[model samples]
Target: MPEFSRLEPHVVAEILRICETMLDEFDQSYKHSFRLTDVHGFGDFDSAQQLAADYRRKAAGTPESARERMQQFIDALTQLRD
Candidate 1:
């Protein structure tokens, strides 16, 4: 069974919302990073993608990044409740 199957409907909705919001934010940030690289003449598509891939690898192994993501979810939930 899925973990969300055990969760209340509203809680599940909030979780999904949080995930969508985070993904949107990540997309925006990614675009901004590329824009910055272009503006500074520092990176190209291959380099940018490589950097992102490297970060993904690092983040996957980093507990701190996981905590940061959890904190982002908690903060979004708090904002929604307030």
Candidate 2:
């Protein structure tokens, strides 16, 4: 295994923690969208489609951010190996 003299798994853990928060927020939006009121509906359909799109963007960004963090970690490890 490669060595990282100062690297802490906490960096990744923190990233995952933040990602989980994003997912949780997304879940809240997803759940609230099921409401029959003005929030997510114009009676039978979604009126807050723009809100949904925004959350969809948020959802997509979470993993990309996490992936970027993970890649940075990997790059650091690779540099140490080389």
Candidate 3:
């Protein structure tokens, strides 16, 4: 596999944090039946769908990058293990 170097660890952490927050909001919104009383205009299905898609894209990208990092880490660890 190709080496992974574009994303720094701190940037990945930040992205993961944002994705977690968005996922939590999406979960809460669904549980409450998309109640507008608590979230104003953000309770609509379309808004939620868009946010979900955006979050998914970011999350997938982050995971792919992280996977590369993790593979590299594993390879390095394996060298020690052997």
Candidate with top TM-score is 1
Candidate that beats the other on TM-score, 1 or 3, i.e. the better one: 1
Clashing pairs in 1: none
Candidate 1, residues 1-82, lDDT tens digits: the string is 6655476899978887876777666555544443332223336788877877666544443545443454465566556545
| TM-score per candidate, chains pooled | 0.40, 0.35, 0.35
Clashing residue pairs for model 2? none
Model 2 lDDT on a 0 to 1 scale? 0.51
lDDT scores in order: 0.57, 0.51, 0.51
Which residue window of length 10 is worst by lDDT in model 2? 33-42
- Write the number of the candidate with greater TM-score, choosing between 1 and 2: 1
Off by over 4 Å in 3: 1-5, 34-82
Better of 1 and 2 by lDDT: 1
What's the true lDDT of residue 73 in model 2? 51
Model 2, 1-82: lDDT tens digits are 7575554798767766766665565555555543422333324345567666555554434545433444455555444434
Error of 2 at 68 (Å): 25
